[model samples]
Target: MSVRIGFIGVGGIAQSHLSGLLTLPEAEIVALCDISRQQVEKAVERFNKEAVGKEPAGRKLEAAIYDDYRQMLRREKLEAVFICLPPFVHGEVEEAVIEASLPFLVEKPVALSLSLAGKILDGVLKKELITTVGYQLRCGSFMDKARAALAGKTVAAIVANRFGRTPGVSWYHRQDKSGGQLVEQATHQVDMLRYLVGEVDTVYAAAATRINNKDNPEYDIFDSNCMTMTFACGAVGNFGNGTMAHVGVPPGLNGVHIFGDNVQVTIGGNLRIATPDGVTEEPLDKDMMVRQDSAFLKAVAENDPTLIRSDYLSGVRTLAVTLAGEKSARTGQPVKVADLLAAEAPAAL
Candidate 1:
């Protein structure tokens, strides 16, 4: 059974999701909605070219574009949707999707305001929807080996980093819009940490706009941040993130290193493992984004939430951790995730 997919935002990330979704035989990219009609038109052009040899029989790559998602939600016979809007613009579309009882795969970080996130989460709970967040970094075979290797072992600590270039988008340069690199770009690493280690309980961070702000006067978000975290499993973690990087930064340096009993696992260009005897390397054997897209569509087709690895609530928790880091950076004190959620979330949430 093909899932009739509609996209809420046709930005760069949404286009990436579209690439993976096109690979699935059971996916039909039927409609698109974006605030910019030109962007949606460009997406349609790309889809027409890329989907020609891929679409199933009797299915054409005809995605009707719309500016208002509510109109798209009402007019289209969509089975699932991809909500790829920015962090600040998340609440209404998600709530409407849940109200319509349509399953969706939303990109992270889920929201900038926890209150709005809580409300949307509450609606998703009441509707019992199948949702996945776009934490595509944790979806490939290297990660599979890492998970299997740590199945029974207790993870003692994790050292992660996301030292990379600033995104080439206007909204991304502002802290109020994208929640800085920590909440916008590095949320991928943060989600991977939560997925591999455990749930975070508290966080303390120090951050500043060191270099990128000087280069671009409009840029206000921090380019350098270092955070300390405590997990529910009594594990400790250190996260370092910066957006001042140029082209020379090695890809392996921006990933994570996890430590446990006689085990040291590094997840970067590949999965590297050391267990007292020797060190071994495992390359990322597959395209992770495709795997993530396949998982979401498969789960939606089967109506089984169990197949989904990361759901909406899990995304919310990850958002809390990143937002707490932002708060901690401002206050110069440790921030508890629970307290942050409780203060911002509604009663039902």
Candidate 2:
């Protein structure tokens, strides 16, 4: 039985998901919706090209396009939907999806604030719908190996960093729209930390706009940020992010490194472990997004939400950490994740 899928946003990230969906034999993209008609049409053409010679015999490679996801959802009988909108455009689409009781795969930084994410989560829990967030790093084999290597060892510290240029999207530079660089760009690192290590306890952060100025006046987000976090397992971590990086420079120092008593693990494109004996780098084979999509499809097919690694509630926790860091950066005080979650616990799980 093929899972009829509907896409809420056909942006670049959603296109990545479409590539993954094309690889699944039981997945079919039946509808696509976006605010821009041109983007919708372009996505339809791109998806059609990708779907060529990839569908089951007699299955037409056609998708209904709409300017609004609500309209598409009402018109199309879909088994699952993918919400790939940006940080700010979340609440209403999610509410509609949950109201229909349809399982969905939503992109990261679920919302700009915890309060909005909590309300959507409330609907999700009440409806008991299968949900997965786009924390694709959790679906990789390297993560599996990292977890196995750190099974019994006590982690002492973690170092995570992200250095890159500002994205072309204008909203990403605004604090209110994308929740700053920490919430929008460095969220992958934050979520990966939570997955590999335990939950974060406290977060203190400092940020400043050092490079982006008159030349890049539109860039309102902080150009550099340093966040310090403590894990519940007595592990302390620091993550540094910067958007003023030179474009030609290779992004080498852009991942998490964990230090334990006997073994130190480095997680990025590949997993590297340094032990008393030697260092080993395990090259990754599977696409993380593909694995993530496959897991979500399986969960929906089997009616089990646990099959997906990062669900709505877990994603909300990750959001809580990043949002706390943003708050800390603004207030110059360490923010407790528990306190943040408790303050917005009206719809908490």
Best by TM-score, which number?
Answer: 2
Residue lDDT tens for model 1, 1-349 = 7899999988999988777676677888888899999978877777677656655532345778899999999999999999999888888888889988999999998899788888888888888899999887777778778877777788899999889888877799988899899999888888888888878989999999878877578898999999999999888999999988875576578788999888888887678998888999967666788888888888999999998888888888888999999999999999999898888764322
| Alpha-carbon RMSD, each predicted model | 2.2, 2.1
Stretches of model 1 off by over 4 angstroms after superposition: 51-60, 346-349
TM match of model 1 to true structure: 0.94
Q: What local distance difference test score does each model get?
A: 0.86, 0.87
Instruction: Spell out the clash pairs found in candidate 2.
Output: none
Q: Candidate 2 overall Cα lDDT vs. reference? A: 0.87
Q: Where is model 2 more than 4 Å wrong at Cα?
A: 50-61, 247-251, 346-349
Question: Backbone clashes per model, in order?
Answer: 0, 0
lDDT of 2 by residue, 127-201 (tens): 999999999989988888988888899999999988888888767877778888889879999998998898999
Candidate 1 displacement at residue 173 in angstroms: 0.8
